[model samples]
Target: MVTIRLARFGTKKRPYYHVVVTDSENPRDGRFLEQVGTYDPAKPIESARIDLSRVDHWVGVGAQTSTRVRHVLNDYRRATQAIA
Candidate 1:
C-alpha cells in the first residue's frame, strides 16, 4: 500500500524530515516515490512549510498520512488561518 510519511535525514542529534509518498513496506528512511513537503523540528512553528495542494492530491489518490505528519498539517492550517 502507498502511504504518506516522513523520511528522516540530518546529522545525529539534529533531525529533519521529508514528507513523502512511498510503499508501506519500505524502510523509514528508504526509497520514496515523491517528496511533498518538509518538517524541521529545529525550526520555529511559523516557519514550517508544506504543500497542501500536493498533499490533497496524494491523499485523494489513496495515500495515508502518518500521525505526526497529520499533526503537522493541522498545525499548518491553524497557523495560516490565524494569519488570514
Candidate 2:
C-alpha cells in the first residue's frame, strides 16, 4: 500500500522531516516515491511547507496519509488561511 508519511532526518535533538510517498512496508526513512512537503518541528507550525497540488494528485491516485502527516497538513492549511 502507498502512504504519505514523514521521513525523519536532521541531527539528534534537532528534527526535520520530509513528507514523502512510500510503500507501507518500507522503513520509516527508507526509499520514498516522492517528497511532497517538509516539516520542521523546531520552528513554528506555520513554517511547514507543502505542495498541495502534488498531495492532491497522490490522493486522487489512492494514496493515504499517516495520522501525524494529516495533522501537519491541517495545521499548515489553517496557518496559511489565517495569513491570507
Q: What is the C-alpha lDDT of each candidate?
A: 0.88, 0.94
Quote each prediction's TM-score: 0.92, 0.95
lDDT digits (tens) for residues 1-84 of candidate 2: 999999999999898999999999999999999999899998998888899899999999999999999999889999999999
Q: Cα lDDT for residue 39, model 2?
A: 92
Clashes of each: 0, 0
lDDT for predicted candidate 2 compared with the true structure: 0.94
Q: Give one digit per residue, the lDDT tens place, for model 1 in 1-84.
A: 888888988999999988889999999999899898888988865687788899999899988988988888899889888989
Off by over 4 Å in 1: none
Total colliding residue pairs, candidate 1? 0
Top lDDT prediction, candidate number: 2
